[model samples]
Target: MKRRNFIYLTGVGAAAAMLPAIPVFGKEISPEQALEHIDPAAKKIMSDVALNAARSKGATYTDVRIGRYLNQYVVTREDKVENIVNTESYGIGIRVISNGSWGFAATDKLDKDSIAKAAELAVTIAKENARLLREPVKLAPQKGYGEVSWKAPIEKNTFEVPVKEKVDLLLAVNDAALKGGADYINSILFAVNEQKYFASTDGSYIDQDIHRIWPTFFITKIDKESGKFETRNALSAPTGKGYEYLNARPEDKIQTASGTLYKGRYDMLEDAKQAARQVGEKMKAKSVEPGKYDLVLDPSHLWLTIHESCGHPTELDRVLGYEANYAGTSFLTLDKWESKKFNYGSKEVNITADKTEVGSLGAVGYDDEGVKCGKWDIIKDGILVNYQAIRDQAHILGLNASQGCCYADNWSSVQFQRMANISLQPGKVKLSIADQIKNVEKGIYIVGDGSFSIDQQRYNFQFGGQLYYEIKAGKIVGMLKDVAYQANTQEFWNSCVAICDQSDYRLGGSFFDGKGQPGQVSAVSHGSATTRFNKVNVINTARKI
Candidate 1:
């Protein structure tokens, strides 16, 4: 339920009003402060206390996580800065398996006495919950890797940048949108840093520091005569990098008449200007005719589709009905995967789940449960080959090792299975975006994510985008307005006619992908080249409110 508004920000002033009643969650460290509260010295001492307590409580298994999460957001609309927020959340989450049942508890107190108590309580809860269990949890064998550490390869710490610098950049982006013809503009910059430490009875201690950034804006244009309005969003991607992601490196730039799209780097001002101009065209563009048309999807537009239709559906927990109360159960079921012949898509579609991609938002050295992360195929050459699974879910798939896709959004939440960076592999041969467009005789080209809706099962869906262009006889003519594409998940992916080669690959992502009962959010990226889907259903959505 995240909206593009500054009203949701409770940082500094009102944040305390939102926190659940709990003991000291962690040290209150500002964004400008060092990430020292969860240092190895403190983590080791604290972890040892919890581990010893759990083992003494007759628990067969236990794991603990100490975390410090920091976030800063700069938001602006039109000519003024709407809000600038800096906030932090820190806590410890403890999980234990007793009587072959899992139980979890979390507390903000970082002291040995508090953490040990939490651990013992978790074991007691696990024992109690085991009473009605029909089947005991079967965990796949895991090896303890002793102590290990990993850090995001960021050139600069976004938190280290001055607040004024970020505010000025966003204001400039809004100004560019206004000058470029947008009647209204709203821009935002989101930055996050997660300092996490995990320890378990498996004899492993893991430490990881991760960072992510996203710069986005919305520009609107109004047609005075008809009083109709249109909006376009910035095509910049959210990446697992630092402020350097916005540095606008020449190598990361992709130029076109529609404007510039970024890969590894982003130019906020240039994109805002592009969105402004695009929105104006959309206001003047012809309304689309309801019909079947080929859709040439840029990564910016296709990522959300992949994230929803592919990533969510393939989650093992969703398929097993564990998340049915929150996110609906998956259409992809055991019957589909056990057959090993389920065609999830066309041969051009090779969706893989990865946590090791260097620049991906989901990239992590290890999952919260201390399982080492790696890459695996979800849909290999159109076949439903594998599904994302954690240690507890791996035995169900007849696998001996976890997929290492487990995660917790914050320190206070228990670790659970989450989606990895699921993406479409590019074509084997060399292909360009231009050449792919030339092959489409009558189609639509869509860029940037917009309004979208999918069914509870992640099957049927309708998606809209920021920019739309009509392709006629192998060329892009003028822009089109009031356009959206609807399709079934399997039908859409199976319609993938061709995929552009690696040179055209790029990324698009979301800063807040929501799931779970209490509703935790995680950031993730999807990568693909220019992909073509034949004869997708397109509809016009131009009704006035």
Candidate 2:
């Protein structure tokens, strides 16, 4: 069979072979098969060698992580195409605990001498810092496991796909948008990742494989008469999948000599054209009068709202003050979780932190610490219920097990608690976006993701979107520009009047979600339905100064 054919067949075959092993409804590999990929003997040897060296040097505890990563990036700007870039990196990092201080070092060379030297340097640094320690460090309790591994579900390997084909496809999308009336179009659809993780300590060992892809496109409309420009973008959420995801996009096409085949490409082009038209209309749009007004937010806009307010504030690290220096702490302190009746929204508001959602950027079978991923609630019935927790943080809060939120961006970085798929549960009623708009006597319909800003506390914020339509007397009049909505976290959630049903819910996320003192970037997703907020304060962008 051809390489592509073999890849496709392997995917199908793996799904069948591992079906019985996976506990989930949809999974491609069994947990055991996933775990078997790691060599237990190698892990044991590495652990013994590293830990013994640390102990001999008078270190208290030690751990090592060996990792390999494969990356590919392809970008296209209008007719200009760039060559696909591929890179491979592998390294091992050693961490040592000595005299109540922690020290770390990493090296790409995996030779025995190099590993030993790295270990020596880590211990030496720990000793040097010991004198500055004010207190002895004590870690939260965790039972050591012998061996473990996890594999994220994927249908194809993005690395196997040709760079020329990827660039061609992206340029085609740009060409289509330009032909559809965009004055200037810039777009990129690229998938760049393959991760191999290995961790070991005095007793525990873990191995994991992760895959990711980020695909995006943007179209801008420029009006020379007014010197004004507006832009719109596709809501293609990054995912923990392969090139198959690009193929699965709602808009994909190829041309043949016979005749023009629709192949769903027309719909994508139509969306782009409509977006451009909206931007053009907005060039002459009047500013929204600053005041409280009933607002209906589309899913494209609502996802980011959820991310800023609910997602960041609910991270246990943020609530506990660990993320204060980088992003500041949250108002939702650990003490207020169970007792606080946070008025997040009406009774319809429900949110969950899950790592199991398919296509989610944060989805994984097991976290970096070898803890199995699972789901939990962040908000229930408009009340603060729980916060995302990793093993150490969970133990600190008197919990027995982790919520599986532990993750490290790279093998060289220390594992920290990170966000998962923080999704807003859809409403019970099957209300459509149009239905929500019809009920509104006067409001604005917001669409697509755009620029946004929020205070450190995740409270006071302003959000802008790709396009806005003016609605009067239960009807969309036309597009509007220079518009933004501002509100406090509590006030905004309290203002939510209604939310659309499951059909309107969609996934959205960021590739570089920063957190921690040293700053680690983790990918996460936010799923939301079209939701309405009452009496939100809208402002004119030009009038802000």
Candidate 3:
């Protein structure tokens, strides 16, 4: 039995006390209440037909995932010019296993006929693939769940905000950057609100809502004499929130907040100009020599390092080669699960996979398979400890239950194992970025993520950053251009000599993270503190190119 279900079934009172907001097992929900948000009749028909269809088809395992996604986009070049785009999509995907092979099918139309056809197609595909099956599927055991509903934290729905207002905000930011001496400026802001419902044969049902937003702007400076261009961007973190995010002023009062926050009335434009000047300086900065050097990496750049090296490789499915075609395989093979000490970093390096973090893009109360999300360690005391797993993957690994990592982007995409918010646990000392740098005699300080390349095995990699600064004699000298750092996964982490405390941590992420055979996109966040690596190779990107 799953620990949660066991707790609920054995001690209802304790469970209720533990989760006061969650509905107890066998609790009745009126049809009227359920119908207010979703179509009860349609849901019941779809669930019943999926179960019967899977059983009649002689499939060993099957599940149905339904997703509804709504998205809005607003773009602006400068001034009052703007463009707005909106979309709504929903569909159902059926996944089945037969004769030790897997198959999937999806359809946008949700009716009895379509649902049945999808299920039949899924089983048929599985049967065809079964002929070439190599190894039989083994699922980790999990307690069956009947029904569950979860809502991600959000203040207001982005859709509820007016379209014109969103555009105006983008224009305002563009104007701000342009006024700051930017020869050209471009800006875009968008939001995605998704509603997902899932049901499986093993008696699991889940309903969840997730929200995400990305607001970005770029300012380009041109040298009239040399025709050289330099670009800078505002660092606005993505969040699981609504339109209120755009107007989140620490202290201000305005009835019509549209386009007001981004306006250059405060320090926003000044900061943009400063960043642009820095970028311009970089165009003439000296190239860094390739050699072993001490370095300080800000959270912006460190996030991607952690993503490629730690996040993808730690996925149980990717390590097992189930996700080889899309996201690539992992170096952390199954044999190293518990025995291998994956020397990730110094003793201060602790990492975790969490889906319950508030305001995180990957934050979900319950995963697609109705598994309650929580925290689990990926690395503890510089040693590899666990891998991110979905229900089926967990079963194969002999885990009694999943860590709630299963997810699908939309109804059409089959649920594949996905990433949560993989984060580095902070150090004990409250060391600031300055403090870490003060300790370095000669090094570089890197900020913001740039282009990156990694091997298919995710072992060797090189990463560039948006901003680079030279540290000479324990102090920042100036900016540096064409900078990139290269290191092997183990070698890089092993070189970690220092790390900042929790106070220096920040969250970073990608809006469209791709994975799976047919291609599915998910949004995930990575949070980390500023960190320092010792005796790492730094190269001039211009020379390498």
Candidate 4:
């Protein structure tokens, strides 16, 4: 069993307590020091040392990854600055295949001697562990792009942004919440930059600079006399961009009956103000009656469902039972995929996994395994068509190349198959959010992610949302609280009755998604338009909890 904090962070809400401590491999750095970048030519020289050493040490294949990961966090509660963190991790990890087995070693020491020693050790370990191999590792063929570089299309690097600017923004957000009658409020701004260089015997030299940022907050309102409280979380999605993501524009805001939803850019201050007002409404909202009702799920609310039920179950490793740590094996067995007749969802459900999507957390030019990244379909016309796979497992599906879903949280962690940007494709038909909702006579509209529970097999599940509104007679009637819906994986997807077109599509993502035996966290985005699911199960969570 994986004995660690498996709960990943979406926003600073209930799961905040379970946030895992980020393992630091290097010394803490100042804000200015975080902006320092290593020259790719210098990294190439060091990488050549390891690759040559491994080849001389009798390794058939080898790869070297030199990484410098930087992070900055600004946190505040109410009007006080709680904490600020700036850290950097720099290291080199070598992976080698020898005697038909794989082995790995990592070190923070970047000198030529250290790199060579690590490479030799990796080969020695691989030879020694060859006895335990069930069969030779069957790696699919991948053409190397000689000396290529990729960088996230960020307008401004977050590390370059002034620390005081971030602090002020978060403080203002908290102030807005407090002034709006919130009993308590906490806000945070987190940013990351990954400077990575990869070299392999496949004759590929890749340099990549990746950036990601998330701005979030939590607000609570307490009715002191009744000893009851309500909470609201930020509706911002983490994106693979720089500080520019927080620069919201007028067109970026989507006006909804429930409130304002952000698209590409986010208005953090406005969101905090709306959250404060909404929390007050939540405190006065009526409890939802337990019964079947059509569910109108916004992208913010549906992303978590897609991540847990659709994304996790389709990982090639999970389907084959090789991955069973944080979450168990999939209900989507290999037989079902091979048959090509498994109805994973309704015809309205067409899911695609894209690693090259702009502004997505998983966007990358090339995967860790030196394979070019692109998009592929996971569910087409309601059938299980494909899965997220890496270089080693591509042959299982008769694939020529990997889907580029491989990632490692840190230099010390081994690269593995991780989810890409798994998204529910927008409907081809031009359907607006209003049109989709008007057709639902008796329904509940859910916005923003909330508490979620899924079984080990990724089948049975229950999900709650941050905001719930009752819909009657083709119109929103009032707010409802204590709302949760339960469903099986197959049953829920088949109930997908309608989906909005591209105009309403948006993204919601997790900045920290945990997986693997040693447990490495990867950030991924899930995109979708507003969708409606027909009559299903609704429960009163107030009575249960």
The candidate that wins on TM-score is 4
Provide the overall lDDT of each model, using Cα atoms, as 2-decimal numbers.
0.85, 0.68, 0.71, 0.89
Candidate 4 matches the true fold with a TM-score of 0.96
TM-score of each: 0.94, 0.83, 0.85, 0.96
**Tens digits of per-residue lDDT for model 3, 8-124:** 111121111211111111112332222235554466568668767876897887778777666666655657444455555667788888888888898776888888888888889
Q: Residue-pair clashes per candidate, as listed?
A: 2, 0, 3, 0
**What are the per-residue Cα lDDT tens digits for candidate 1 across 168-215?**
998889888888888777777888888999999998889899999988
Residue pairs that clash (backbone atoms under 3 angstroms), model 1: 24-108, 25-108
Q: Which candidate has the highest lDDT of all? A: 4
Q: How does candidate 3 score on lDDT?
A: 0.71
Error of 4 at 420 (Å): 1.1
How much is 184 displaced in model 3, in angstroms?
Answer: 1.9
Candidate number with the higher lDDT (1 or 4): 4
Residue 524 error, candidate 1, Å:
1.1
Instruction: Write candidate 4's Cα lDDT for 235-263 as tens digits.
Output: 99999988999999999988988989999
Tell me the tens digit of each residue's lDDT in model 2 across 1-545: 01011111111211122111101111133222222343546645665666677778878877777765554555555687633444444567677889888787877666677778888888999988888998765555555666766667777776666666777777777787777666665555545453444444535676666777866656666777865566666655667777776664443432211111122112333444555555556666777766666788765567788988999999888888888888888988766765677666667788999998877888876676656678898889888888988855676566787888877766566677888889888888998777888888878888767779999989899998867777788888776777799998878887877888876667777776877766667788888877888888998887443
